[model samples]
Target: MTTESSDARPLPTLTRRSGDDLRCSIARTLQVLGDRWTILIVREGFRGHTRFSDFRRVLGIPTDILTSRLSSLVEAGVLERRGYREPGARERFDYHLTAAGDALLPVLGALAEWGNEYRPSGHGPSRLYQHAETGEATSIAFVTAAGAVVPLTDIAIVPGPGENDPGVGPTHPLAAHH
Candidate 1:
């Protein structure tokens, strides 16, 4: 005998909460990616960094912090240590981004665009990107499938009524009084 679709299995339960204070999805996502170095490593990894020294040289990250960040990223599945080698100059190994890590480029693009607008000038960017053809700033934007620019207001925050809903929750600072 065959069981019905919904009857075949029950929804898996949450065996543990993330932490005492952080309970939301955004919080959980941030818990993994929120490290200051994670996104930078991701950005550099996208630019084709596959070794420890390469990340070190590009980011100028402190050795201790960089070590922690790399380990965290590997555990988070954002990177994978593909092989072990001792080039006679080293005793350990190098790391590479998995396909999962390569998929974070859009997030980095969004962040870069936001920073370009909000971050103050004179606070030099460690590096910059330019168009190969014209050699001008590489401005990032979001476009739809048919190639139309998507505006920020077009984005919506949809949270069902259960866990959290800001619309009906405590008023935000920007919220208008009713």
Candidate 2:
């Protein structure tokens, strides 16, 4: 029996997420946080980049794209704009991360770990996450219902309190495919 060549690229699986009935938190989240630009903006905000000019200078992003992303973040309650004046300058907006935005640290950590492990950029990691008190490097993991951190092998996904049939039910065709 012959196997497919290792160099072969697999065909892309086409699927459309059910946005109309997006009762899933992850779906609703992706809509607001949007894309890599939005996520990177949030990361920079966490890194203490509050001003628009600094975001543009560091990210090298176009003003229009930065403007749109900042607006969307504020609208989503993930960021709050505060009036600030630098020395002799007139008042300008500084984007501050909200409580909801602060809660995404775990998600960011998980994504960073996955990227470093799988889809590397050849350049070694540019930054590291450390525990504030212990000063040790930190990593993310899946925890159990009992609050015990466990390996992916030890975990199981079952129905939870938030589980519901929101029109696009659990049996939705795309659900199994994913």
Candidate 3:
């Protein structure tokens, strides 16, 4: 079933406190998706499980926890809830991933790659990402704006604009560059 709604409205922007706030993007992202169940729910969404029952059945998530995660996701704009009704049944909602949620594909891919390397199941990957048309295997990487794929060894964490805030102390040696 499709989750697109003709009357769908844009989600509100989430506001974070400025100055003295943790300047870590990863930490900020984790604020919304730090829990195991939240990530698994998003995985289920990618697997095309839109309805609550489907998510419960696939993940074996408890109803209360599943309900809380879905609600949090919808609040965080990761999932959009669309109402539907069947025959004479009351209207219910199906959760679909928003653009923000869909953006987590690479995060999931990277996690899968790491798990396959460090926490293998002894058999092989249960899932593999591939190019839709070419059918070639795909993996996540750090690519530059000019399209250069940088190796992990070459990556350096530099201070960003947020890191330059007066309240935030220089935690990295490169902070002087800003």
Best by lDDT: 3
Off by over 4 Å in 1: 1-23, 86-91, 120-150, 161-178
Candidate with best TM-score: 3
lDDT (Cα, tens digit) per residue for candidate 1, span 74-134: 7766788766667675456578877656666657766776676789466766456677698
List runs of model 3 lying over 4 Å from the truth.
1-22, 164-178
Residue 91's lDDT within candidate 1 is 58
What is the TM-score of each predicted model, taking all chains together? 0.62, 0.77, 0.81
TM-score of the candidate numbered 3? 0.81
lDDT of 2 by residue, 1-178 (tens): 1123343222222233764424455656677775888999999988999999999999999999999989888877788899988799888999998877787788788889999999899998877889999999988986656879976555545544455744432333334445
Residue 133 error, candidate 3, Å: 0.8
Candidate 3 per-residue lDDT over residues 77-173, each given as its tens digit: 8899999998999999999999878878988999999999999999999899999999999988978879999866666765567665556443444
* lDDT-based ranking: 3, 2, 1
Candidate 1 matches the true fold with a TM-score of: 0.62
* lDDT-best of 1 and 2: 2
